[model samples]
Target: MPKVSKHLNAANLIDQVCKCLDEIPDHRPNHCPNGIPFPNFAKSAFAMMHQKYDSLLTFDSDRADPVILHNLATMYHVQDQKVPCDTRMREVLDPIEPAQFRKPFKKLFSLIQRNKLLKAFEYQCGDLKDWYLMPVDGTGLFYSGKCRCQECCVKNKGKPNEAYYHNLLGGCIVHPDQKVVMPFAPEAIVQQDGDNKNDCEQNAIKRYLAHVKREHPHLKLVILLDGLFADNPTIELIKSYGWHFIIVAKDGNHKSLIEAMDALCDQEQLSYHKIIDEEQGTRHWFRFANDVPLNASKLTQNVNVLDYVETDSEGKRHTWCWVTDIELTKDTVEAVMRGGRCRWHIENQTFNTLKNQGYSLEHNYGHGKQHLATNLAYLTFLAFMVDQIQEMASPEFKKALKERARGVRTYLWKVITRVFLSWMLEGWDELFDALIYGIKPGRVQINTS
Candidate 1:
């Protein structure tokens, strides 16, 4: 008998996810040719995503077996698999409503909040306490030559050209100390008829505002962005939504604003800083504008502007600027600076983690006409969230990480991949156990009986 330990239980992560997944609508298509139920495929695809696979179907067929649900349930360590066939899974996903996949984000967030994970990341503005910072950005996902659907936002050139795709603004509350970026509602950037030649990031931000308002109602939001989003209309819309704005104010884009800030700087009342970070081997020069006029367009809202220049040990200077609604005072300046600079957390925590850290976010999952793209994208993010939780909160897994550096720990993934081919334990718990304490050499525990 192969003694398998139940150490790698990623339970809290799964519990939070289940809170969201339970809300997914169970609408089985009556026209599924094979009469296969939809929930089985849904569960299986979700399991494949949790395992960080590029294609759920491929992972089902090639990795474990062609029986989707059985393989998935087994991988999850759940017994009694009612696995569906790959063709049936695809058919079920094709006709499913895209909105069904979204039912979970709100619920999942509620779970996280209830669990007090949200409060773990907190900062202050003036007298304001427990304020959270959310940064918003967009990214493009898929491109294909031969497949284009009504949902396809862009198409490649030539007859069999692949279609181009886009996903709209992903807003998340991020902190520099945190490993995970808690995701909020995302707006999809789709093609519109003659409204604008091409829908843009700012437009997507407009779309995101209502949903953010609906879901978060009273939640304080400080929307951070790049310079392209620092326009008068965008600022006005953000004000209308009753949210604060913290956007990049680049000299190239906000020339008038920069000029105004510079004029204010000459008056000597504005805030400024000159500091050297010996540890980082860099020096910084920073200036800020408090309650400055944004543009000549007569916008009534007030914004705080921050500017910074960095000089490396090699004598290279880099400059950046931003505008925000967060109050600027003697004490809150550093917190706001940290929040402003933490915008890179989305890149490091969300995008790069998905790409390089085993989530296979850019991999070509099933490109169904409707829900597949968004559904898979959500799953990839969910997987990253789970892994992050395990790394941070799971003492067992963290010990595994501590035993080896990140590179070596990643190399161990190859070992799991090989083990997955030859045999199956109960689930990730068993896999972790076997790795930490090797299974008996000749014992086979895959339940071949």
Candidate 2:
């Protein structure tokens, strides 16, 4: 254990976040031989996002304005220095392809794994009792009333009768102890002319699986999914990709399939039971069903099922279910239940954080007639990953955060606002000194020269 505490020391984490930005090719130079130094766009963006999440700042960049602002945030509070009024920020992001932005997501996964932040997932799924469990799902983030670009998914409305939607198929490896769910590259679901639309979730899953395998052939994962993905073809496809699955199996969705499972269970054919206690003050009773025929049709594959009933503090009884590729046993039921329940982490941890936390994922920062919407969303997610990593791994930054005592966004906004007021602070260290050493505002000279 790394002696976990509440105070967040996020500088090293900030450094890590900056490194992700470094992976991006900077066209601007530092001098004649090196050109002018590239502006710290990553830090500025992160700072802005952090403030936005804290509800302390807002900038109106309607026609690609350069200077960011805060109606309530003071000039002395500004952290990011203003750049020349060039449309370069938008131009720089405009041409960058979406595929190139996706590279950082993979880097995030590698960094978490290397730093042991993801160690909590060592064995939460039964199939890989020693490996991690990754569940894949898809979601749509941007939708527009106008036909934005060629890659847009079009839909017909009542009057205007036209719109564009952007969606991504996302996947994450989940574990009982991990607070943040690690997300993979999202496959865009778009539309095309003369075609019904672009790929749906089913096809997206197929391509995503292939991509994951091509990249991490030896990685161990047990895919968990909704009942929509419990069919034979999907199962076979998953198995072929060399991954395990724990999909939802509802009696209503698969009537014949559940009937077969019931018959087998009644015959005392390899069925078992177990009880579990969750950290969230919930109790779960699990009924394990294994090697049961998934379909009554000609094509059937034997799969494992775990039917669970949970009772929470409010005395609400919730019925849940899952089908897995792992064999059911007394030793594995607890792990199965954990993987099944952690499915909510993707929605709660990943998507919710992106929406409610500082990322403002749903907010329309830029709705370019081209790829601006999707590109901005990617940038926000990248910033979010950096924040989560800092919260989980960085110690010094965490401590400074604790002393600040406010939320991450609030503290960051104060820093940014202070910078804009032309305070004497040179770097984060001087800023921290001003905050801690009680250097009153306007009492010191900010050495911009």
Candidate 3:
């Protein structure tokens, strides 16, 4: 049995979180000074998302069990064995800015970088060295018609009572072959302090990039994005940061650009490369051109275009087109295309896992008058980062994943919740050890006599 690295185990990771969130400035009014410490409030709230509990009430119920309370103290660094009630926790945390959560994410990411765990996610090509593939996109947080708060963005579309929703522009360091994604700090798209118009994805992305610049200015990134981000301003923002981008370009959205590609194809200016594999019975093709204007404007920005198509043994074909800054040679086109196509990983593996797998990301945990909903989203994303971090580095977590259900997180979270509730864990090590080995081979037989 290999020992999990001191820097990589689950308890050590959550303890790092404890050290960060422990400094969350006290927002409670001085009139009521008997409130629980901010660490307990913050981490107890985070525990709900980490354990995949559906509601604040559900997670709060565990406070009744002394053994579970002990485990919470042992595992999550919950101070004083006291988990706050749902209402108290929400009340205490609501006023604190969601930005506070970014600290833990930066700390965790620093660990990954300093310990060389991010090497598995690196993408390199000509002139692009030690760069990570980061997929950037937006996803909807929960929405409601009746539970409106000052923070919600309204979508009326000519209706009297507008439906309110929250969204986040998220980015993650990703790889085509890996299922686990290391997420960046998520940006909440909500009404600004004094803005009259509804908030938007473009504005959220601007803030997201600002935060990325402030937090991690040195890392080289190849940003993978969808058609919505193919516009001029988004293009210029990425370029301003000196980072590279590969964005999907649809004909309907970028008519002038696609027409330019077609014109070049007619003139036979495009270079084509194909790789056919007899073992897989498939053919991969790349056609590319460089130094084309992104639009018909006289001063429009220029990009390199690469079109990819894959043909199966049955002759069925699928195609994708992208515009990027990378110089697209025969060798480089395929790697850039893979990076472009891997943008879907943010939607499939990260967001889908949060929405459907068990995190209940869209569920309304609490909609406080202040920052409850947004902070809850941050907590959920943080929980996901912890799980992803363990998947990347922890041997014990890997072992438990195999012993339980072969890396299925839903099963892993479920058994961890049940076992921690039923038994006492001195730390995460014992729990994972119990899971890696057998908890019990067989239960006692029921007697009807």
lDDT scores in order: 0.64, 0.61, 0.85
Error of 1 at 302 (Å): 3.3
Comparison by lDDT, 1 against 3, better one: 3
Q: What TM-score goes with each of the models?
A: 0.83, 0.76, 0.94
lDDT of 3 by residue, 1-449 (tens): 22346688798889988899998887666734564667788888787788888988888777878787888888888887778888888788888899899999999999888778878887878778789999888888878877777678777645877787788878899988888899988988887622323237767777888789779999888888888778788889899998999999898878998888999999999999998989989999998999999998887899999989999999999999999999999879878877887999999989999899988889999998878898999999999999888877888888788878786878888998888888778999899988888677677565798
Please count the clashing residue pairs in each candidate, in the order shown. 7, 32, 0
The digit string of per-residue lDDT tens for model 2 on 1-449 reads: 33332222333444544555556666543524332223344334445554453221233231123223331112112223443122444545545566666666776667676666656667654346567777776666777786476667767734576777777666777677877566776666655322333336666677778877876777777787878778888899889877777788887778886787678777877455646455677776777766777878766888877787888877799987788888778878777777777777777788777776546777765555556556666767766666666556555335545666354644553554454334433345554555544555455445696
**TM-score-best of 1 and 2:** 1
Better of 1 and 3 by TM-score: 3
Q: After superposition, which runs of candidate 1 have C-alpha atoms over 4 Å from their true positions? A: 1-9, 15-23, 31-35, 63-71, 74-80, 155-163, 193-198, 240-242, 265-270, 278-281, 404-423, 443-449
> Which candidate number has the best TM-score?
3
Estimate the TM-score for candidate 1: 0.83
**Alpha carbon lDDT of residue 281, candidate 3?**
99
CA lDDT for candidate 2:
0.61
Rank ordering of all candidates by lDDT, starting from the highest:
3, 1, 2
* Full-model lDDT, candidate 3: 0.85
